[model samples]
Target: MEVIAIQKSTLEGMKNELKELLELTENATQKYAPIFKEEKWLDNQEVCLMMNITKRTLQTYKDKGLLPYSRLNRKNYYKLSDVQALLKAGQPYKSNEDGVIDQ
Candidate 1:
């Protein structure tokens, strides 16, 4: 291995700069900490129950791009915020010939 030497003053300056950079990063992280809070996730069953919809309907929503989800371990997970936003959007349902609302 080749031996390289850095001046003591240069090393000290590098350390100081690194320390300052770390402090700035930490401060920025803390400043926006609330925005990065852990997101609440809901599984398929929970989402269906909360939205009062069937699993097939939930699948339909996903297919229609009305709701976004992540699948892991062969299970689907959804963001609570996205579900709430869909609810707030008040997506209308279709009516059947018998005057029954079809969701």
Candidate 2:
């Protein structure tokens, strides 16, 4: 009976661990807080993440005329509309919403 109790406790602990892991994953997957997908355009950081590039790379794209962007008070920005257009140009993307590349 003691052995059975120990096994049961171990199983419960593992279950709790699994639950925590799942919660962590869920939170990570929801890392992005979409506050402007419906009402406003996207910013530089959002476009950078969407294209899997950095802010400097974004500036390069802007300079190359490959991507449209703007600057306000020294802060650069990219519009969601522009991102959609770039996608049409075959810029390549992982996924539209999730930003996950296909493996």
Candidate 3:
């Protein structure tokens, strides 16, 4: 009877430990699910559409070192954030309400 009681207690302890481990794994997945979302790189054609410019003009910026991009497997790919930064930098702002004075 004593040995049986000890074996039962040991089994209960292992069950409790496994339950705790499963709960911890569930919590971690809930916390980091978004971080694992798929990311698709935007290409030059898509970037030109987003930036509202002609392909020739965008190519000029790429050649001039004003924009940063990556060439992947013989094709150009731009991070959307980096493209947004380039567009923001190139935007013509009406400084002092003078309306796009070429300073």
Best by lDDT: 1
Residues 9-93 of candidate 1 have per-residue lDDT tens digits of 9999999999999999999999867744767889999987887776767777888899999876998889899999988997545
Ten-residue stretch with the least lDDT total in model 2? 94-103
TM-score ranking, best first: 1, 3, 2
lDDT of each: 0.82, 0.68, 0.71
Root-mean-square deviation of Cα positions for candidate 1 versus the true structure, in angstroms: 8.6
Of the pair 1 and 2, which is ahead by lDDT?
Answer: 1
Tens digit of lDDT per residue, candidate 2, span 1-103?
A: 3544458789999999999999999886676345344445677878877877656656667777888766768876667777877867766423334544432
* Candidate 2 residue 103 C-alpha distance from true site, Å: 20
Question: How many clashes (backbone N, Cα, C below 3 Å) per candidate?
Answer: 0, 0, 0
> Whole-model lDDT for model 2 versus the true structure?
0.68
In model 3, the worst 10-residue window by lDDT is 93-102
Best by TM-score: 1
- Where does candidate 1 stray beyond 4 Å? 1-37, 92-103
Clashing pairs in 2: none
Model 3, 1-103: lDDT tens digits are: 3544468789999999999999999999998676445445689899878876666656766777766778858998877777788777873321233332232
